[model samples]
Target: MLAALILLSVGIIEIQAGGTPICPTITTPDWGEVSCSNENNVGSRCNLSCQAYFDLVGTTGDAIETSCGFDGMWSTATEFECVPIKCFPEQVSPENGEVICSANNFAQSVCVFFCKEHFDMVGLSAANNAHAICKDDGDGDEIGQWVSSDGSTDFQHPFPPQCQPIRCPTTMEAPLNGQVICSNRDYSGSYCVLFCRDGFKFANRKEKIVFSSCSKEDGHDSVGEWSMPDAPSCRQCTRAEEVQLVALIHESEGDRGQYQVATSMIAKVLTILRRRHGINPTLRVNRYSSSVDASNEVFTTAFTLKSSKREIDAIPYPGKGANTTTALRYMDQRLTGDRSAKIAFIFTNELRDFDAEMEMKARNLVEREVSLFVFTLPQKNRARTWIREQLVKITRDDTRVYALPRMRFTNKYKDEVAAKINDITMTKGCDFLI
Candidate 1:
C-alpha cells in the first residue's frame, strides 16, 4: 500500500505541475511567486509564478524580489532617473561669465573673457570663478566707459571746446553830432571828440554818443557824425545879390513866333537854380499875330525891354527874315554898352543860315558885356558848317552851346539835363542871366 501511495503522490504532483489537478498541490513560494489557499480544501495551498518576474536577477545572480505590501510600500525596482544638472542662463556673451550646477548638486562658475573685433574685455580676467567685463576701443580720454545699460561704451565726448568771444577795445568813444570818432571797425561814438569841416556846422553836439561792443548781439558799426542835427550839414546854400532876369517862352509860331521847347527847358533850368542857389526869376510867354503889322518889331522890342537886366533871348526859327532881323537889331541896340547884363541866347528846332548872321551880329553888338548860351535841338539835319563854326567860336570865347541829345526830351533825360545845366551855372560863377 505504501508503494502505491507513493506512486499516486508522484502523479498528483505532476498533474499539479501541468496546471490542473483534482486536489491542490502544496509547494514553497519562490521568486516571482504568489501564494494562495485552495478553494476545495481550506487547508490546501498553491504557488503561482510568472516567468517574466522570475527571469530578473541581481549582479550576484540572485532573483530580484519585488513585493506589494498591504501598507502600499513598493520595493525599489530600478534607480531614480539621473537628470543632467543645468543652469538658469544656458549661455553668456564673450567677456561674460555664468554659474552652473553639477549633476552631483555642486555649483560652478564659467567666464568667457575674449571678445570679438571692435570690442575689448575690461575688468578682471574671465576665469572659472571671476566676472568679466568688456568695452569698445575708442580715441578720446575716458574711453571704455559705459554709456548705456546695454553694455555700450562711449567713443567720443558729447561736447567739444570752442574759441572764446572777441573783446572790443575799451579806449574808443563816441563823437559829437558834426564829428565822430571812428573805431577800428569804423564804429562811431558820441563820446569821441569831433570837429566839423569848413562848410559844415555842428547840428547836435549836446549828448555823448556811445558805441556798443562789436559782437553777435550788435550787428554792425554806425555811420559817423554830421553837420545838421537830424541830418548832418555838409554844405549850405549862399544867396547872391544879383539883378532879376526874365525868360520868354514861345509856344507857337506867327508874325511873332512861339518857342515851346526852348521855354520848357528854360523853366526846368530856373527851377533847379532856385532850389540850388535860392534865386527867384521871372518868365514870360507871348504869341505872335499876323494882324499886328509891326508884330516882329513889337515882339523884338518887348523882349529886349523885358530881358534888359539879363540880356538873354530865345529865338525860334531864326532863319525867318523878319524874326532874325528884328531880334539882331533889338539885341544890338539894347545890349550895347551894357557890361553888367549877361546875354544868353537859345536857338531852338533846327538852325538856319541866318542863325549865323544873327550870332555874329549879337557878338559884335555886346562884345564882352554879354554871355551867350545856346541850346540846340537834336536833329538829323544840323546847321551848316559856317554857322556851326561861328557858334563854336562864340561858345569858346564867351558862350555855352549845349547841343541836347535826342533823348533829352523825355522826363528822365530832362532831369539829367537840368541837373547838368544847374551844376555848371551855379558852380561856375555867372551873371544873373535868365
Candidate 2:
C-alpha cells in the first residue's frame, strides 16, 4: 500500500529498454554515391552524388538530399539515379568526311571513319587499321577516345581521321602568252584555270571565246599522272581596229629609277602593240611638280606607232611636283573626242585632292568609255596614306587600279609588271576607235 501510494504520488510507472534507433538503411544508387546524416535516424539527412560523366536525376532542389521526418520515413522518395553523358554523333567526323558509330554512342561503342569521293584519309588511319573507341578505361571516366589498331594511342582527345582533298598531277603548263594555275599539286578533283596575257588570246578560236578548266577525272588514282590530254596555248590577238595608249609617267623627286623603268616598259609596250597587234600606239611622257610653272606638258608628242628606243630615250624628264592633281586634269583634257576605246595609264605617287572637280574629271573619262588604269609607285613617306580610297570612288571600279611596291629593277620583276599590265589590258579591252 505504501508502494502504490508512492506510485500515485509519482503519477505513473516507467520501464527502460535498450537497442539501436529505428532508422531506414538507405542503399547506395548505381553509378552514384550515398551518405547519410546520423545513419538515417529520425531527423537525420541523406545526400547523393553521381560519378564523373554521370548526372543525378529526380530531385530539383539545391542538393540531391532528403531528411528523415518524425514519421520514421524519408521525406523524399523517387527514382533518383545517375545517367551517362553521350556526345553528338556528328561530332565524330571532321568536315568532308563521314563517321560510323558502333552503338549510337552507348558505352563501349566504336566508330569507323571514311572519306567521300575524290578525297583520301591522312595519318595512320589511312592505312585501314585504326578506329575510334568509346571506352571508360575503368577509371570512373566514361569518355571514349580514338586509338590505332596496333594498340597505340592516336589523338589525346580521340579525334576523327583527317580527310584531305585528292588531286591529279600538274600536267598543264603555262601558255606562251598566258598563265595556268592549278588548285593542287597532286590529287583528284583539282582544277587548273588559264589566263592570257595582254594583247594575246588563246590560239584556238573555240578556246578564245570559252575558257576551259583542267581537272582530274573521277575515280582517278592519285598516282602522279595527268588526266587532261593537252594544255591550252595562247597567241598574239589581232585588235578589231587600232588601239591607242597614252601613258602619263610620274617623275617625282626620288623616282629617277622608276622613271627610267617606266620609259623602258613603255617602249616595250609600244613595240609589242605595233609589231604584234599591228596597232599604232602613241605615248606621251609627263611629270608631277609643285613649281609654279610646272606644266603637265606632253614631253613627247604623239610619236609613230613603232617608236624607236632612241625616240623614247630622247624624251625629257619633268621636275618634281607637290601632287598629281595638275597632271590628272591634263589627262582628263587629252582623253576627249573620237579616241574610242582609248586607254590612259597614269603613274603617280600621291593625290592632293579628291574633290568634286576630280570626280567630274573621272566621270568625264568614263563617259568617253575610257579605261583609266592608275598605278601608284612606292614612296618612303609612310606617314602619308595613299589616295586608294579616292581612286576607288572616282573610277567606280577599283579593279582597274593597281599599286606597286618599292622598285626592284630585276628583269623578272620588270617582266612580271609588264605581264600584269598586259593581262589587265586584254581582259578589259577598249572599243574600236574611229
Candidate 3:
C-alpha cells in the first residue's frame, strides 16, 4: 500500500478496492419532513422529524435519523410518518369538578364538565352548553388542545373549564335594632344567625329567629339564594323611659349657622322623644362662653324643655367664645344626680386645651355615667382634627361622638340621627351597619 501512496490531505487514508451502498431516492412522510446531506448516495444518512405536537409512528425518539443499506434500501421500521399526540385522562379536569369526554381527550374528543356539591362550574354559563373539544392546536402546532364550546375563547391561558365556590344573591343584610351574622355571608350552604339588642324582639313573639340560609335552590341564574322565609325584623318590646338631655352650644365668632343646626336637631329630638317613644324627655339648652362676664354668668342658660314649645323662645343667639374648659368645670359642678341616663350634647368647633385639668373635668363627666355626644366640623381642616381626637378621649366611647359639616344637621338626616339617639336609650349602641 506504500508503493503508490498519494497524500491529498491531512489524515487521508489509502484507497481500498471495496464498494459502498448506493441507495434510491428517499421520500418524506405526509406528517413529517426528511432531509439528506451529500447527494443521498453511498452511506448517506437521511434525517426524519415530525411536525408540531406530532410524533413518529412506532418510534421511541424524534431525534433519530434514517440510514441507507448496501441493498439500496432506506432504514427499516424507521418510518418518517408522524401522528397527533394524545392528551389527558385526568390532568385536564378542574378541581372540585369533573369532566367526562367522549373520546378520552384524544383527537376529535368531546368533554362535558360538572361540579361537586357546594361548587360551581365557572367557565361555562349553563350545563346544557358546558363542553370542550380536543383537536389540533390552532397555533401551527398539530398537537391536541382543549377548545371551549361556548364560543368564548378567552381563558386563563390555553382555555380549560374551571370550578369555584357558589355565592348567594345579596338581597338581605343586617336588620335595624338587631344584627345578622353568617358563617359565610357571600356563599352557598351558609347558615344565618340573628340577634336582637336588649329590650327588643322579633314581631313574631313565638319564634325568636326566622329560618334563613343560603341554598343552591332555584336562585337567579342557578348560582345561589337565601331560603324562602327571610330573616325577620326586630321591634322594641320594652316601654320607653325618661331621659334628661343637656345641650351645650359652644358659640364662636362664625358658628351662627352651625349653632342654628344644632338647636334645630335638638328640637327634632325632643319632638321625637315625646311623640314617638312616649318618653317624658326633659332638655336644657345652654351656651358656654369665655367672656369675663360669661365666667360669672357662666354662659347663660338659653332654653329648657317646656310643656309647650311656645313657652321657651328657641332663638339662635349671636354669642362669642369657645371656652369648653370653663363649660366642663361648670357642668362637673352642676351635673349632680343619680339619673340612669344623663346625656350631655356638646357642639363645638375647636378644642382650647389638652391639659390635665381639662382631661379631669371630662373624666368626671364619664365617671358620673354621663353619655357625652360631641359634634364638630368635618376633618377637611387638617389643623382641627385634634378636636375630635381630644373629644374621643373625653367621651371614652367614640361611637357616642358625631362629626359632620355643620350644615348637614338638617331634617334630611333626621331619621338617621334620631335612630342613633334611640339606640343610646336602648343602651346597646348601633348595629354594624346603621
Cα error, residue 431 of model 1, in Å, equals 9.6
lDDT digits (tens) for residues 148-223 of candidate 1: 2223233232111111222343434322224445443322222333444433333333222322333223222112
TM-score to true structure, per model: 0.30, 0.37, 0.39
Best model number under TM-score: 3
Error of 2 at 54 (Å): 76
All models: lDDT?
0.34, 0.56, 0.61
- Candidate with the greatest lDDT versus the true structure: 3
Candidate 2: tens digits of C-alpha lDDT, residues 1-434: 01111133524322112322233566777887777777665677888677654646554332377787644457777236676645444336757778777766765556777777666666544565446655444333334443454455645323566766765444567677778777754455556677667666665444443333434343323333455446556666544333446667765575566665666556655555556544454445555465323244443334553445455455566565554555566666665456234567766667765578777777777777666767666666454455687877665677756665544432324444344445444443322211
Off by over 4 Å in 2: 1-240, 290-320, 381-384, 408-434
lDDT for model 2 comes to 0.56
- RMSD score of candidate 3 (Å): 13.4
* Residue 255 displacement (Å), model 3: 4.4
lDDT of 3 by residue, 1-434 (tens): 11222344433323323434345555667768777775455567877787655766655666457676555456654455677766544335688778788877566777787777777665554454678776665443335566667545454433355677788768457667888878877677888877676666666544555557877854225468777445667776543244556667664555456566666666676666656655554555566656223222222223334523332234434366566777676555555555345667777767775677777888888888677777774333346734566888877777767765655555655565566566565652211112
